[model samples]
Target: MKKTTFAFYRKTMLTMISLGLLLNCSALTFAEENSNTDENQQVQEEILVEQTEVLTEEVAVELQKEETVEQSNKSIQTPKVHFSIYFVAEANGEVTGQTKFDSLVSSDLFSNIVTAIPTPVANEGYEFSGWYWGNSYIGSTSSEVYSYFKRGAALSDLTITAKFKQVETPKVHFSIYFVAETNGELTGQTKFDSLVSSDLFSNIVTAIPTPVANEGYEFSGWYWGNSYIGSTSSEVYSYFKRGAALSDLTITAKFKQATPKFNVTVKFVTEGKGSLTGNVTFDSTTSDLFKDVVATMPTPVAEEGNTFDGWYLNGSLIGTTSQEVYTTLENTKLLESTEIVAKFVENTQAQDPITPPTDTPTTPPTAENPQPEQPVINEPVEPVVNNPGQAQQITPVAPEVQDETILDDATPEVINANNLDTIEEEVTPLALGHDSWSLINLVLTLGIAALAIMMVIGKKTTNDETRKVNKNAKVIGCITAVISIIIFILTQDMSNPMALVDKWTIVMLILGLVQVVTSFINYKVKENNEVESVNC
Candidate 1:
């Protein structure tokens, strides 16, 4: 009985070793068969690992060769085994349903089987950390292959909870404000305040607001603290950034006012009989300070005997012009309340005529019986006076007209019987021995001599007209010589012959010499021309 028991134990040990080998060989065969499929290959690799561990240290001692062969044949003949893989979601990620895995397995197959791995889903504001198997972390892979070999043969269900790290996106807010200068308003005024993401943290793309129309105001630019942000424009936008950890940002849009103007008044006045022309009503602003305004002065329409003088400003003479006066309105004095005047004066050349008294009778009175009614006339008169002793009623006679030019320098003289006849002979001489006879004789001599000289100079050859003119010149020359000599002789007084000879006598003598010289020259030229004509 002892020998039989020892032999039985040895056989049992041998069978267990053979079965363990068969199980290992069967696991390898399954791994080779499904190696082409990714899921199947993964499952087979897991099962091979578990089976190797068991076969290495525990499988031979547990089962005999016959039993191991029976389990291997049973696993190969049986259909696929069903198992559940549960995926739990976290951090707003997508939840996964239970996944089913089917595979042929043996008693050792459960130790080597691989579990189904679910695909990881994404979530905003959260980063995927890693996958979890119950309370333990599996891997960071999205679709990692899981093995349940360590769970043993009774393991059929798996619970994997998805893990995630909470994303910390700090919130930021920016405030925008519209600011204006004193008494200035803005148009399209607006403000902004909202939450922004760390990735989406940027400036606001908005144009700066403008001032209202006709407000005389202008928009400058947006400002952040003391620095300039941007200019004002309809198409422009502003940018806001967080520079500090706890930022308190506020921007301002600035505006400015317009410039002021001044008032100016000008007046135009006439000092003479003239008037102001061209926009006399001068009231304007200093906006056109660079330009000069002109005011034309009207021509002075003086009275009958008056003349225009010149233009004056504040009693001082500016300039003189007979046509029109022009004054510059740009003068600083004219910018304020001021006036300009035109002056005139009487013409000295325009004088009134002097007339004799009309009340005096033209008739002269006798010394013995002068009419009491006749006024005694101290001034000179032209009618004749009768010296009859009896008082005779005489008809009033018209006074003789006298030459004003001649009387301008001559004094009146009374004529008596003794000098009456001599005065009449001197005044109305029929011959050329009168008071103006010298001037007439000189004028005639000069005129005739000039004509003769012109004819001689102009003549190419001697003609009948030429000869006639020369003969007339000779006759006038001889008459002028004789008259001059006679006048010279008459001007000298025998009683006072040494007295200063009158200047007129010397002039007459000089004229006589000139006439004689001119006549001789004319005669010589005429003779030469006549000879030339004859020779031709």
Candidate 2:
């Protein structure tokens, strides 16, 4: 029983195995068919896409052809323009002829355009002036005219012409004259004749000829027909007008005789110091002209222990002043010559340099033979010794009388006239009333006062320079004032106090003038400074 059952089970197992193999084969075949169908759809889609691309390319080519046709239609609508330049020829107020060749210019051409300028043809007795465009002138030659035309732009057609005219010139001539004289007499004459052109002018002579003068004569003035022209300087015609000078003219020169002069000699005879006279000039009596000549007089300088003496001319005292002297050329006295001498001597009023004698006489003076009182001489004196017996025997001597009156208290002292004359040799004469020392003292005082006043004025003003000047003025004024006061005291007695100011009147006047001038200058400067500041 067991063997039969096992056989049936085996048969069932085989049948199940066969069914499984069939199911697997069917599934694989269905999968293969689906893949082939997907491949066929993909090939159809690729073919449709290629056809759509070809149709778009054809549409673009047709649009390009239409655009090309529209461009060709616009190109035929516009046209280019061209222009030509012309030139003509003309004569004086007439149409002469035409030129063989003319300028050919075009508006189409740029800066590269070049046109030929027509050359002027030959004409009888006619000069070619220049080319002309209406009222505008070009040049005389074709080359010069073409240069002007080339520099311009060609806007339109135009024409130009060449002008001609005749030429002429003029001739001219001139002449000049000169004259000279010596000592109011004619000496010589000069004539200049020359040719000139309307356009040309020249100097007649480079210089004037010098005139000859006779002995004791001099050239005076130049004259033209009795009218004074000028000096003997050269005249010129560097600037001359055509046909202006045609006829010859005469000029005259004048002269005069030289003047006479005199010699003035100076001599210093005194101990002081002095200047007398020197070289001087005077005009001649022959000439009407007067020359102002200043002759310098000697400066009187005082020596130690001495004073200045007045000047003497021909042994006679003339004056004591040492100022500048003036004389005319016609003075006959000066022609004979002049000589002046200055004298100086010791000052007796000054303190004595030597000691005096102290002894007194024992005998009383009688009225008939009065003796001079013993003098207190400053100079050295010899001593006398009286022997008792010799004094009784000696004879009485008479006293000498002096020209001047004796003082009431002292007995009159007698001196020789000749000796007194020697002492008075240097004394100043009061002929002029003013004493030199007194005058000088008074002047100095006045000057000092005036200077001080000026200083004050300057100080009151504005400006640094003015102030400095004022300081100097003040110092000088003070010094002068002190000196003047000392001089005034020494010159006069104390009894005449008012005389000090009165004597210095001239000096004061001069000083006042100086102060006024200085003040004026200071005021002007201050005003100028203020004006400058305002301008700034």
Best model number under lDDT:
1
lDDT (0-100) at residue 508 of candidate 2?
Answer: 49
Candidates in order have lDDT scores of: 0.53, 0.51
Which residue window of length 10 is worst by lDDT in model 2?
323-332
Residue runs of model 1 more than 4 Å from their true location after superposition? 1-83, 90-131, 135-156, 163-170, 173-214, 224-246, 258-275, 279-536
Cα lDDT tens digits, model 1, 1-536, are 64465457667766766776688678667768866567776776677677666645554444465466567777787565556445667766764543444434443243244344566676887777787766777677643333433434535666667777778765546555556545555667455444564322234424456655236656666676777777745323424343422344455656665443345544556665555455554555654231233334344466667676777777877667623234332433343445556677878662222222454343344343333342433323333233231113333221112344345435344333335654332332233333333444445445545644554465454576667667666666656655654554555333331433334646655675667676676667687778878898
What's the lDDT for candidate 1? 0.53
> Which pairs in model 2 have colliding backbones?
259-284, 270-344, 275-298, 442-504
lDDT of 2 by residue, 11-30 (tens): 55455445544554454456
